[model samples]
Structure formats: structure tokens, C-alpha cells
Target: MSEWTVHGSRTIYTSPWVELDLVDVEPPGHPRYEHHLVKWAPVAATVLLNDRDEVLLMWRHRFATQTWNWEIPSGIVEAGEDLTVAAAREVLEETGYQIDPRRLVPLAYNQPIGGMSNAEHHVFLGRDAVHVTEPVDAHEADRIEWIPLDRIHEMIDRREIVAGVAVTGLLQLLARRCAY
Candidate 1:
């Protein structure tokens, strides 16, 4: 199949986290028209492990989804910020678990929404973490805890870890047993 041809794009709105664009495009064997395109900031997240082989997780309430779930530390990568550094920053800010940026190794990369959005995710694996301070972003999660890696599948099966990025990171860790 041929690639979609983009003639032009007009920004409808934009913010630090998201942008709305109307792109003039022609898909193969289709009519050319303006399509709504969503542009999102790339996200970075980490599935961190402790010496006991437990995974660090947070019990969070997502207001938009109106659901409570367990998730790994994650946040939008800032402009010009290092992806690994950003993942480490999120770990500390959201969970109070300080991790060496260098220790974070890439585990998975995915563009969650490709047809209508430029949303992307980078998931990392961290073999070590240290708690140096209380969480700086107190509003991020209500509870932070270490979960046994063996229980991840149960939690996921029960929909406890429903966030796509979080699920992706955890599943990759389980599938590959990635040691870094």
C-alpha cells in the first residue's frame, strides 16, 4: 500500500500537551480531504524493580476515565528534555522513587494512535530504585506501593493496570524478563 499524501496541515488549537490539526490528505485509492488530526506530546514511563524483585506502582484515579487503576510512573516528555531523564523524573516526582537515569533502559516503543493522532509512548525498564524523598507531585497518586512481579498478570487480568502505557511496560517486562 502507498503512503498517505499530506498536502498541508492547519492548526486548530495547540497546547503544551496536545494540538489539534486539520490535515489535507489523500489516502491510497481514496478521496483527498481534510481530516482531524490530534498531535500529542510523547510520553515516557518506567517499570522499576526493587531488590526484592517487586515492581513499583501507584494507585491512581484518572479523572477523565473516572476509574481507579494501578500504573507505573509516567508523564509527558518535556520539550528538549531527555527521554530517559524524563522517565526518571516522573518516577521521582510521582512515586518518590529515585532512579538513575542511566539505569533506565528502553523496553518498548509504540505509537498508540496512528490513524488519527501522533500519540507515542516510550517505556523503560529500571532494575534499581531508591527512595530519597516524599513525592513532589502529591496529586499524581493516592497510594504508592511495591507489587510482586508474579501478581502483575493477575492485576492486569482484573483490569487493575489499565493504562495502555503502563500495561505495555509491565507486559514487556514479563515477556522478555529484560535484565539491565
Candidate 2:
């Protein structure tokens, strides 16, 4: 059992994308405290690798953070949608690449911000992706490229790849490749 207990929770706001709540929690040695909590649909991220040993990346500006960085294609898994299907659909919509759902290998999952949010990100490694069309979402990326896998660590060291999901996904793929 956890050392803390949630006594009650009240919804502060609700939207199609996210929900916020105020939770009353009691810890072992402290009085009850109210914590702000956020709930969101789980996300699926794909590390798409082409035959040239390059990984697909999107370069875009995140308004919230006011920083431009490289990120993997990812999106929320809609209700009633299969995880793999959702990941492939996100890749197609964001990068104009059609990837076989079967080629999506589960890599790892993470909760990037457990203190304030209850959202899980499922990461996958996809291979054999083919360009089908331009990105359907105009804001998906300012530019897309297939960057050499060998330079991922260098990019990370240069702080060009900053998104948590993308960094974790790529590192997992790199680790797995080295293990083989």
C-alpha cells in the first residue's frame, strides 16, 4: 500500500484534450494537502527508421516552451483505438509516412511527469516506412528529415533533441541495436 491516500478529488476543468482536478491527499506524517492534478489521454510515439539507417524527425516550434527542437511523431491514442494503429496513424499524419502496423515494435513506456499528470507515453520502433503524401497537419512540423542514427547521440549532446519521449525512444532503439 502507498504511504499516501487520496481522500477526495474535485474536477477543476475539463476539455477534450485534458482534465484538471484538485485532489485531497493524506500522507503518513502530514496533514491533508490539496494537489493539482492533470489527466490526459495516453500518447503513442514512433521512432521511424528507414532502410538507410536514418531516423525520421520533425523540427518544429513548441509555443508553450518557446523553443524549436527535433521530435518523433507522436499523438494521443483516441478512445477505442488500438495502440499500434494509433502510433502508425500519428506517423502518417505528422510525417506523411505510411508504416506497417506490424513493423511497430514496442520499445518502452514512460510517465514523463508523474507528480502532476497521469498520462502514459507508449514508444515504438518502426521500420520500412514509405512516404505516401505531405503531412496532413499543417502544424506538425516546419521541416522533416531522415537523420543518420549514428548522430543521434551527438544531437542529444548538442541539445537539439529535447523532447523526453523522442529522446527515450531513440535511446531505446540505439541500446537494443547495440545489444544485438
lDDT of 2 by residue, 1-180 (tens): 457889999999999999999999998878999999999999999999877889999999999999899999999999999999999999999999999888688987999999989989999889889899999996879999999999999999998999999999999899898542
lDDT of 1 by residue, 73-99 (tens): 999999999999999999999988889
User: Cα deviation in Å at residue 176, candidate 1?
Assistant: 0.8
Please identify model 1 stretches exceeding 4 Å from their true place: 178-180
Model 2 misplacement above 4 A: none
Q: In candidate 2, how many clashes are counted? A: 0
List the global CA lDDT of all models. 0.92, 0.92
What's the lDDT of the predicted structure labeled candidate 1?
0.92
Reference-based lDDT, residue 147, model 2: 98
